[model samples]
Target: MPQPHQADGPAQHAAGRQLPAPRTPSPRDAPPLNWGVIAPGGIAGSFVDALHTHTEQRVVAVGSRDPERARAFADRFGIPAAYGSYAEVLDDQRVDIVYIASPHSAHFAHALQAIEAGRHVLVEKAFTRNAREAERLIEAAGERGVFLMEAMWTRFLPHIDVVRQVLDSGLLGEVRTVAADHGQFMNPDAAHRLFAPELAGGALLDLGVYPVSFASMVLGPFASLTAVGEKAFTGVDGQASIVVTNESGAHGVLNTTLFARTPTTASISGTHARLEIEGDFYAPATVRLISREREVLDSYVPAQREGGLCYEAAEAARCVAAGRLESDLMPLDETLRVMRALDEIRRDLGVAYPGE
Candidate 1:
């Protein structure tokens, strides 16, 4: 077994093999930006609430195809303006950035519109329907000179920062494998978004992206992957089990399903140690470092419980304030790479969305 290194470097461990403290800054420290939200959906509501409860940022406007829905969301959140169309939100002079919270199928078009309007954009994840859309958005953002980011909220969480520090510090020796799974039981109704191919509905885009992104974060880039999948009643992918190999020959075992609830846990194993994240690992949760002997060396618990969405918002706000086109933590290149990997998986599984 490989032994953990004792180094005087960026991360300083505690006495007796303790974990490093997370270097994440408070969300409130980020410079404030006026945000306009598109699509008053469930995720949007949570995002707006997190921003209001934790950051100095303000949501100046909200827009939806349905006027009453936009008005209701605005009133609920105390936002100043409610528009009946996404174009109205894009046209608002006060919006420094646009947050596109639309469904997976709509991410590309909505984010493209925001970029064309010269508004910095934060797109909800599974950034686009495929790698092609992701590339176009990145190119458009470059031409427009506006910031663009996929809101992969887990990447910005405090617990994840601790995991990053541990990996960087070599506490886990030669990292060999990463394993993660995310699954949720969804209704079988054909009309539900998860079952509709037109909406890009599937286990992979909606539920699998978490484990795939987590694996990408730990393993860098995918060199090759093999996938086995099953389809839902509506012809959308219902589950997938994928094994990926990175350039360094490290392996990532990932799984996702819409047919059952899973542990949703994740673990990274190395020659000397392993780090395990609690269930619902994509959100704020406990992280524990274990030794080769299976002894717990250290553990970390997050300070906040419910409003974890604010961290990603704060990251976007900071990036825009610093005149950046994308975040260092979740770069556009990585986003495209992940999309390519997802595309490969979909192809292997024979899962195709309607109209590309």
Candidate 2:
């Protein structure tokens, strides 16, 4: 087992045992992967900034309906080429994979298009409008022998890796209860993206997913779920609270909102200790692990790098070069499982999309 000294290390198995070390590939073992960008949006900007961290990755081109928009994005990020439409990038033989950042409603379509065009995909999260849409992309990717992964960027962050490590070490004892929340105040205008039905806008698909994903990360799939959500006049959920229970009786509480301020906090409690994550729990930040003795152990403090978002881009580059279709840490099954949980939560809350 690694001492407290290796705080960023992978979680060791319980009983003071060491888990297997990560096997690194030699130069002879990996292949080249040239990446493309589809839908130049705000979230894509983060990917653009983060992708610069990897020498192994290249953002060859960008595609959008508005040619000028695509060119401007390319220029801002130093990408080499821009296309007038997504179809062009999908058809580009030089591009090995595509990172998608369209609206939630378009994730299914965009991912399917990329898969059909024989390109691997890293899709932005909340993978789609619902589990059904997510499963569609997954099935198509499987059939096409192409890679498809949800861009659950938080799960790939350095801090989250460290969090997983701490939990597995048994130093926290058996995790008994969990809590996470993400909230923000969004304007109520129907034209705003948060309230626009056309964009598939709402709190649950937006800020809500992070806390829910965090809970699932710690607790795994819940055996049962219950939720309550407050809806906007536009009929979209403005806030939601969900409770999930594991077979072991562990309780997970998650909250998300576009209607209130929620501190954006998180914690995990166990027989021996508890961990309190600071503001912006999903990103680069600090967490305090408290013990029965009231001692505090902090990890992931004063991040060596800001905007830890780039780590996911680096991880994808490594995985693709190593011929991996999906990340070992963030597997396709896990993505589907999260979507399924979200789907059930929406159902229980009486939230339904236009088509549904």
Candidate 3:
């Protein structure tokens, strides 16, 4: 049996082993940015809270289709300006970057608008309704020479870096399988955005993206994929199970659902060992590395925070300050690849939104 090693810090293994400590810079370490929010939705609110509480970033303005809503959100977040339309926010020369929190179906248009206006953009996940849209936005951002990134916040968290270190060390010995799931018991009403086709209402876009992205982080882009799902009354997929295989013969099993709440856990198994991420893996959480014989080798638990969104915000700000057009950690190519995988999953499920 392979013996574990101990280390000098909390990252020590049982057998005198030591993994490189995660090098996550503090949010305050990043250069400050003058941010504008494109949509005053729940996510935007959470993002604003995280930035205000943990970083030097400033949310100078917020915009919404509803003027009253914009003002209300601004008040809640202590933002200085509120706009009745997104164009107004973009027009604010004071804003250096825009966080596009609009619905998935609207991401392409909003991101393109920001790029055209010569502003950097950090768009929410499910970057767009489909990969084609993602490709177009990526091309536009590249041509405009502006920074663009998908706000898959989990990718920047400290724990994920630790996972990366573990994988890079070859301690796991050829990861062969990755399994993850995300589910929430959302209201089934057809009018609810979670079930409306016109809104891109589906578990895959909102919830599955977490697992799909998680798998991609571990397994890379899928070489082939197969998916099965159940549709809701509103003609959207309520739940789905997907199996993706990469060129190395590694496999990823992923699931997501709007019909019920699940454990939201994830695990990666390799030839010699495995790593188990605790429930809510995509968020700030814990991880355990175990040997093939089920011996616990090491464990990691990140310091808890009010919210972890600040990490991604800081990364974006740092990249922008460094004059990088895209984050290496969450590149446009990777985002496009993940979107393509999602498109395939949706196609297999026979689910299509309005306007394809």
Candidate 4:
């Protein structure tokens, strides 16, 4: 472990320095692409809405298992095509990319379908059921030479860009700890996806991913971790608390649960200063930089809020236009590392999905 820096007057005065500004470009500046939506659920609606509101990208087609659902979604969003099966979305010639907003268990299959159809893919977060599934999708996308990314929207937000700049500038000195938690009180009905084993549902995959990925961004890959969890009535993980250590010995303390509402805040503590984020840290929230003596140095608040998801869409559009196969901001390798960490956490918690 690296030794902590001794507090010096100059170092203490460092907090008075100006913080870096976000360099994220405007969503409207990216090249437009026609997008297809598979599994037109609530998240897909939000994504399409964001794109339509903030970017030039078009949602040309939508697909759902229920024909009515598909048509309804398409009509609601002014989409041109609606199909009864997800395969139709993948097969649509007009779609340059397909967004997979299916449930956890369906991500691998839906993304693979899009890849096989030669469409770029953006799978929503908790990218897949496990690391193995994540690896398979990445390898498939690579073999096909198509763009693939996990819709970790937080990574693309302007505030997050500011966080990235701060970390890279070494303004915080050596980071020693990261702490984040996300919890939501959910209806525990067995049929709801959150409590369903068949759908690979759990608090860890749905709610925990934010904190885990945030820690990964701040502390690099996890080297080792200790996890303990409780099960809901439906035999799925209800809550989990984890302490992860990175290769540099920095620690991440994380927690997630479906039984209660948490502050949903996050923080990074380093030798010289600390960065703190407001509740719903994974979304467009305020970020604060503070000295070790607890003086606020600076803070950041977004100028826009309603369509924050457009940032990720803009990134996807930019990468596709540049012919890049994956985003440097949310690389496939990091997705896999985070998945492996989640897998280990689930393993230690004795949580397993029905169909693997």
**What is the number of residue pairs that collide in model 2?**
0
Model 4 — which ten-residue stretch has the worst lDDT?
1-10
What tens-digit string does per-residue lDDT give for candidate 4 at 1-356?
32333444685445335567799999999999999999998899999999999999999999999999999999999999999999888788999999999999999999999999999999999999999999999999999999999999999999999889878767788889999999999987988999999999989989999999999999887888899999999989999999999898999999999999999999998887889999989999899998889998899988887888899999999999999999999999999999999999999999999989
Off by over 4 Å in 2: 1-32, 53-56
Q: What is the number of residue pairs that collide in model 3? A: 7
CA lDDT, candidate 2, residue 267: 91
- Tens-digit per-residue lDDT, 118-194, candidate 2: 99999998898888888788899888988778888888766676678767666666788899999998878988877
Q: Residue 174 in model 2: shift from native, Å? A: 1.0
Candidate with best TM-score: 1
Tens digits of lDDT, candidate 1, 1-356: 23456564544445326877889999999999999999999999999999999999999999999999999999999999999999999999999999999999999999999999999999999999999999999999999999999999999999999999878767788789999999999989998998999999999988899999999999888888999999999888999999998887889999999999999999999987899999999999999999889899989989897999999999999999999999998999999988998999899889899898
TM-score head-to-head 3 vs 4, winner = 4
lDDT (C-alpha, whole model) for all candidates: 0.93, 0.79, 0.90, 0.92
Give the 10-residue window scoring lowest on summed lDDT in candidate 2: 19-28
| CA RMSD per model (angstroms) | 2.1, 4.7, 3.3, 2.3
Residue 88 displacement in candidate 3 (angstroms): 0.6
TM-scores, all candidates, are 0.97, 0.89, 0.95, 0.96
For model 3 the TM-score comes to 0.95
